[model samples]
Each structure stands twice: as structure tokens, then as C-alpha cells.
Target: MDVFEAIKSRRTTNGYFLDKPLSDEHIKILLQSASYAPSHFNSQPWRFVLIRDKARREHLGKIAGRSMREVMAKGNFWKRYLKYFRFSKEETDKSGDGIHIDNMPAVLKPFIKYLFSEKGGEMMNKLRVPYLLAIDSKKLVSRSPLILGVLLTKDEYKKDDLSGMYSLLALGMAIENIWLAATALGIGVQFISLPMEAGGAYWQECIDMVQPPENYELIALFRFGYIDPNAKRPTIDWSSTQRKPVSEFCYEETFGNKWIPKE
Candidate 1:
């Protein structure tokens, strides 16, 4: 498949065929594509956990649902405050003595809405697809820091202190590769960052199940299966949403100077 076509057509699958399963060969191909994604200094920090057990997937779905509900119930107070302040700033700043105080909600409202929506819970439940792929990484650096030499010793890389931004970028590229492969194979795939909240626990359990490096962190999770033909697909606005023109995004030697013609 053409790379650009695959990228343009790839969409997150919500309704998956419950009984359909991807063959081992196809899964292997998808993983191989992901493995070839670019990494910084050849320090491939990503790992994958494939969950195929139905009972385990169902348990995870329930746990995710409960977590969603708990987060929503507890988060409403702040959500309401932010919503009120965002739409009614004058009312938000009113005081008993007519002295308007700056009582604006400090947090971003869109993030809160995402946390409280049913789509959030649905996204969690959808992780129960036929193949649940989880990616992990070492929390600490290795004895030899490959080509980068960014680390002095294994102890130098702390999960909290060490920056994994490049590692994450690589992982994202890998995920995109998998998505494109799945699209070509007529398979459904969805990526979830939900497991991040339970990453510590998940990695602890994984460590018990598999011999992992002394220090590692769970990075991402994915669900794969067949698309449900009967499901109602959500409509997407392709026209209004667009990438900024090259002129708007690129600049010359200095910032804000157009690098290309505006029109």
C-alpha cells in the first residue's frame, strides 16, 4: 500500500468483530514493521506485551471502567468549576462586597471533559480486542549507552529523572507502522495510552511473569482484531480539519518569516 494513502485512510476502529482473530503470521508482520521504526542512537527502548487471554482482557476492561467512573465522580467538582468560570467569567469573579476577585479555574477544561466522557470509558473497554499489545521500556539505562553515551552508569538513568521523549517518539513511529500494516491487512487497530496510569503495577506483574531488565516501565498498549461491518461508523470532518500551509508552519532564518509563498 502507498504510505501516504495508508496514512490518510488509517482510522481508529471502535467496534471490532468479537469473534475474529488475526493470524500469527499477520501479527508477526505487524510487529516486524514496528520493530523497524527509527530510534535515537539505536537505543531501542520499547517492549511489547501481547494479551490474548479472554478472561484477562475482560478483567482489564472492568478495571478500566471502574477507574473511569471513579475519576469522573471525583473530578466533577473541578469540572463544574472550570466550566462555570470559562463560560461565565463575570459570575465567577463576583464577590459579596461587589469586589470582583480572580477566581478563575487554573486547569485546562478540555482535558477534564475528556476524562469524564463516556468515550473515555469506551476507549478503555475497547482494549479487550482479540490482540492486546503492550509496549514497555527500561526505566534505567544500560551499562553501555550504545552510541549516545548519554549515561555514565546504569544508576544514572532514573525513571523520574531520565527523559524518554525520544524513546516515546520512536514508539509513536512504531505504533504508526503497526496501524498502517493493520490497515493494509484489513484488520482493526487502536492505540491506548490508558495503561499509563497503571503502568507501574502492570510492569511489576509483567516482571513476575517474564524476566525483564532490573528497571523497566510500560510504555504503550494496542488492540487489534477485525472491523465490525455492521457497526455505525462515526462521521469525520475532513474538510474543516487540515494541516497548516507550509508558509504558515515553516520560516526562514528567523522565526515568523515565510519560507514559502502563502498562496
Candidate 2:
């Protein structure tokens, strides 16, 4: 696939992937793509743990579900990410940014905003939205054909050192390489983030399962598989394809200066 086209078409797959394992050849390409990413002075601080075991995926799935439930129930999800939510076409169109909450059960349509607010925890719990999300999270992770555990070496990931920032930037590029490669291969990727977001025993369990060495830290987890065209959408779903125009964000060298591109 053309690089530009692959980048434009890349998407976060929310529904189930085809119930098939990834070929060893494709897995090699994915890892190889990451390895080729440029790092600061070629420090190459990233490491990956690929999880394809059935029982292990199931256990991680349960932890993800429980973490999602706890985070939403405790209002942490809302407190942190409410700014990135768009409830209607009007809002989404106006912002041209942020994820649009375009799909949900009819019961949530009326109170979607409130139900996602910190103050609505009691009412949301009554409706069991968190429980529903938990089930969805569990099923999604468990059904995935692969779970990628991304890690960074502690030697290069020092928070106070200049190499710390360099390692993080390098890893971001590596992940982007993985994403673009997956898009070219007709695979889909989505972050398995609830455990990280919840940040407690749930997160520790993930660390234990990934079993990173003491010198490395597990930084992120992502589920991967071929896209399932006939897969159904979740009870609560969102889309973030909308993006702000370059003019809306780019500047003419100096900050706040307007930038206009030629047609």
C-alpha cells in the first residue's frame, strides 16, 4: 500500500477481528518495522512482548474488564477525559476534533452527557453502564488474536535525563511504524488501556503478566487482529476520524501567527 494512503486509512478497530491467528511472516514484519524506527543516536530503547497464548489473553481480558468497570464507576474516566467527548453532530462538526459519541443504546441517548459526568456516578451505576463497558472490554481483548506489550529500557527511560525524553519520542515513532504497517497489512490495532488508566492492582497484574525484566518497564498494551467487516458495534461506541484543519493548528513560524496554505 502507498504510505500516504495507509496513513490516511489507518483506524482504531473497536469490534472483533477475524477469529484467525496472525501469520508468523506478518508478525515478523510488524516487529521489524518497529526495529527500523529511528531512535536518538540509535539507542533503540523499545522492547516488545507478544502475547498469543489463549489462557493468558483471557486473564488479561478479565483484568481489563474489571479495571474499566472500576475506573468508570469511580468517575476517574470522566474526570480525566470528558474534554475529548462530543455528544452530537453539531458539536463534533464544530470542533472538528475529539471523539464523537455517535453510537449507544437508546437508554443512554438522552442522558449521555450526564451519565459520563463525575456527578452522575450514582445514576450511571444504577443503569450499569460501567458493567456493560466491562463486558465489552473483556470480550474485545479476549477475542483478539494478539496482544502487544510495549516496553522501554530503564537505562534510557530516566525521567530526569535528556535520554528519557529521547527514549519516549523514539518509542512513539516506533508505535507509529507499527500502526502504519498494520494498516498496510489489513490488520487493526487498539490500545488495551483500562488497566493503565485505573492504575492499581489491575495495572500491576498486567505488569506481572507481561513479565518485563526489572530493567524494563511495560509502557503500553495493544490488541491486534484482522478486521471483521461483519462485526457488530458496541453498546457504547465512538468515532475520531474527524481532525482539525492544518490552518486551525499550524502557525506561520511564530506562535499564534496565522498560516495559510496554497490550494
Candidate 3:
């Protein structure tokens, strides 16, 4: 696929991937693409762990599931991230960003707003919503054919210096390259992020499992596999494809001057 086409096609795989595993060739290609990202002083500081063992994958899945349940069971998750939830197409169309929660069990329709309300925590737990979501997360992740752990060399990712920021930027670019390459290869990718979000012991467990060397720090985890065309939507799901127009984000040479296209 063309580079531009791959950028346009790349998406987060929110549903289940195909049962088939990724081939060695595809895995190598994904990492090779990341190698091309520009790093500060040519210090290509990224490392990737290709996790293919079934037992390891299942263990990670359990961690992810528990993390989800932990986060969702608490009020802070909803409090902190509620602004990003768009309940309807109209909401997403107007905002041109953020995930649109367009799929849910019919039972959740009437309680949608309530579920996000400050008073909903008790009711949410009563309904076992977190448990259901945890189950879904576990299945989506554990059954995945591969889990890729992204790490950055501590030498370049130093916390006390500007190199850390530079290294993170380079790492972001490298991940983008990998995502685009995966798109071109017909592979789907999604961040296994709840463990990080839940933080505390949950995040530590993930870090322990990924087991980055003392010289490297694990920064991200992603699941990769062939896209399943017939996968069913989860009990609840969100899709974010709408993007803000250039005029909304870009500026002219002078700040505050909105970018406008010439007719």
C-alpha cells in the first residue's frame, strides 16, 4: 500500500482479531519500519519484544482484565475520562474528535447518561458492568496471536534531561511507522493500555511480565493479528475516526491565525 494510503487506513482494532498468528516475516517488517524513524543523534533507542508464547499471552490477558475491572470499579476512571465519550453520531459529528460510544447493550441505552454521572458508581457495580468489560478485554487480548512490548533505552530516555523528551518523540514516530506498516500488511493493532491506566500494582505487574532489562524501560504494549471481518462488537464499544478539520487545529505563520485554503 502507498504510504499515504496506509496512514489513512490505520485504525485501532477494538474488536477481536483473527485466530491466526502473525508470520515471522510480518513481525520483522513491522520492526524494520520502526528502525527508519529518526532519533536524536542517530541513537535509535527503541526495543521491541515479540511475545508469541500462548501461556505468556494468557497471563498478560489476565493482568489486562484485572486492570480493567479495577479501574472501572473505581469512580476515578469515569471521572477522569468522561469528557472523551461521545454518546451519539451527532456528538462526534459536532466535535470531530473523541470516541463515539455508538454500540451498547440495549439495556444500557436509558442509563447511558446515568452511567457516566457522579452518582452512577454504585449502580454500575451492581450491574457488574466492569466484570463484563473485563471479560471482553481478557478475551480480546489473550486470544490475540501476538503481543508487542515497546521499550526505550534508559540511556536515551533519561528523566533528568531533554533527551527524555526527544526519545519519547522518536518513540512515538517509530510506533506510528509500525502502525502504518501493520496497516499495509493487513495486520490490526490496539494498545493493551488498561494495565498502565490502572497504575499502582496493576501497572507494576505488567512491567514485571514484560520484563524490560534494567537498561530499558517498557513504554507500551500492543496486540497484533490479522483483522477478523466477521467479529462481533463488544458489549460496549467506541470508535474514533472523525478528525478535526485543518482550520480547527492548524495556524498560519502567526499564532491564532486559523489556516484557510485558497480557492
Better of 2 and 3 by TM-score: 2
Candidate 1 lDDT over residue span 1-263, tens digit each: 89888887787654334355567888788879888888777666566666666555554444433433343334442244343322223442342121111221234233423433434434323432111111111100010011010111123234465435666666678778888988887777654333334445543443343334566544444567766678432211001112345676689999988799646
Instruction: Note the residue pairs that clash in candidate 2.
Output: none
Q: Cα RMSDs of all predictions?
A: 13.2, 0.9, 1.1
What's model 3's lDDT at 63? 92
Best of the two (2, 3) by lDDT? 2
What local lDDT score does residue 38 receive in model 3, on the 0 to 100 scale?
A: 94
Q: Scored by Cα lDDT, where does model 3 land? A: 0.91
TM-scores of all predicted structures: 0.58, 0.98, 0.97
What is candidate 2's lDDT per residue for 24-96, written digit by digit as tens? 9998999999999999999899999999999999998999999989998888787788888888888888999
Q: Return the top candidate by lDDT.
A: 2
Compare the candidates by TM-score and give the number of the best one. 2
> Per-model C-alpha lDDT, please?
0.46, 0.92, 0.91
Task: Estimate, for each residue in 83-131, the C-alpha lDDT of model 3 and write its tens digit.
Answer: 8878888999999988887888888888877887778898888888899
Of candidates 3 and 1, the better by TM-score: 3
Preferred candidate (TM-score higher): 1 or 2: 2
Clashing residue pairs in candidate 1, if any?
139-216
